[model samples]
Target: MGNNEYMQNAVTGWMVPHGEHSDIVMSTRIRLARNLRGFRFPIAFSDEQAEEIGKLVSDALLNGGKTGYAYTRMSDLKALGRQTLVEKHLISPQLADAVHYGAVLLSEDETVSIMVNEEDHLRIQCIYPGLQLENAYRKADETDNLLESRLPYAFDEEFGYLTSCPSNTGTGMRASVMVHLPALTMTKQINRIIPAVSRLGMVVRGSYGEGSEAPGNVYQVSNQLTLGKSEKEILAELANIVSRIIVHERKSRELLLGRSRLSLENRVFRALGTLSYARLLPSAEAARCLSDVRLGIDLGLIEDVDMNILNELMVFMQSGFLQNFEGGELTAEELDSSRAKLIRERLRQRAADGEPHPDEP
Candidate 1:
């Protein structure tokens, strides 16, 4: 599909529900930072150097026996298109903001993407639905190997992979998982979970990763130290920690259900009611309501509405996606109205399909 068509579609392969703990764990991602042996990092590189690096990486991936890979230059894309990519987690904001030399090589399913000249020479990334760190890492490793054979990566014998930042100098791997923790957040236990994870050499960032807000109760949990650790160690440690957090979140959900079923149900259905009928809904408010509705679905409080719809809504309600859908930049008020209309039509259509509600026999 072309870029426009790709953006218009609501679901990417990574957003589909699959793998372990799909309900709570949204996705697993593995990213490796590597720079070319003969080139400066992106920050210090001249425009000509940046262009050459982008070409080298793009050519390697496109011709590296990857049948479905397509390359696109960042400068060629409109602002809306670039922001839509950021919203979908397909590309980083840094790459999207590149003036002349940033580009991307993305597979057809979007499971694999390479960011050329962003924070490093290449940020090779692989993402999959739910908790599948090993699987994601395997794919990323394969891609890294493919490119390493064709390009000279900057490396030191004692330091492992050389990167722009000292923190990423060793293994140059960052493994992360995006998780839905509405129960923990609702119970006010997230404050405690963050510091605990930090103590274990992990971090809990917002959904978009570093310096982003966690709308819809979605958070990205990733390893902090890539130096002095092997890829296996980092992946295993992160997986174990995330598993523990999942247990805590599930228990918190049970606590909420046991202590205040009526109240929880009221909050969920009320959110759903507003989404189904509201004439205007701000983006942030839509996210909060959707989180409640998704929590309800996971807890068996709501059944007719599928989890996939909620996942799509999470992206569709974003400002960039809404504007792209409307075919123009929108005022805040216009965005709110369009977002509400989109949500209403989607939720109401699901309900109108004659699916049995939870109360039905």
Candidate 2:
């Protein structure tokens, strides 16, 4: 798809947007990794073979399915554009660097995306806005089934599906939820729980997924093993764990309000104050401040600020997005200044409309 379409469509179609329990449950996602029957794994392929594989999947997606997906050649996108896609969670970091041989197929609404020739020959994923595990899984499964019918997928009667990673050999399904655990973080609970969750075969990774660090108290929790587990079992187990975490987060919020209401208010308002007046804010700092502000809004400590502003900030505040918004490349210093200006303007606009003022802090 064109950059215009990607820029417009991705933001609107983000899964698990801000909503009920969304303060804790940011989004739910299910990813299925599959390989074509005869193609060598991407690493094993010659450049010629990779090109052929790309065309093969691209053709199948564009012509074989009823789904109206827009296809974008990875080679056509600039590095910043590709990074923006990663920030949107519509593509993986590996896929961003796929360079000449990779491509992505995204549904018009951006709910479903298939990464061609990533870690696996194809990574088909579906996303839901909130804590909808079953819904995300169902959509992902449906998309996978349709693709399997149209293309030959490598399978083993003994192992299930083959993938580049041995751990993904069986169901090749990874179901995960992106949650905002600021309360858990603030209460010093997440540090204690992370290792415990790891022992349960659950993995907690940063917001950008595996190998990334959790920023702004946002965490992505998912099952660690896809092998030997049925899709239903996997989804069920993940849902149970996520639901419990949701409870813990909610309780943490309650505890904060009951025991440290003044402290909480000070922290949140300070964050808003920085965002309102800072002339230059780093992306990491912006993320931290935004998290506090978003938490304040969700907890009703601050009202009249729309959730959409926070959600949109998560995207446009990123470095690549800042450059995209300004329609050119930006030096690091310029990006910091621009990010601060954007946040200041948005918050001020809301305040001018008679919303809660951060000035009190």
Best by lDDT: 1
The TM-scores of all predictions, comma-separated, are: 0.95, 0.93
| Model 2, backbone clash pairs (residues 3+ apart or across chains), number | 4
Clashes of each: 0, 4
lDDT of 1 by residue, 98-199 (tens): 848899898888999999888998999999999999999999999999999999999899999999989988999999999999999988999999999999
Model 2 TM-score relative to the real fold: 0.93
Evaluate model 1: give its TM-score.
0.95
What is every candidate's alpha-carbon RMSD to the true fold?
3.3, 3.1
lDDT of 1 at 109: 87
Winning model by TM-score: 1
lDDT of 2 by residue, 185-298 (tens): 998999988998888889899999888988788899999999999999988888888888888988999999999999999999999889888989998899999999989988
Report the Cα lDDT for residue 286, model 1. Answer: 94
Clashing pairs in 2: 15-129, 16-128, 16-129, 16-130
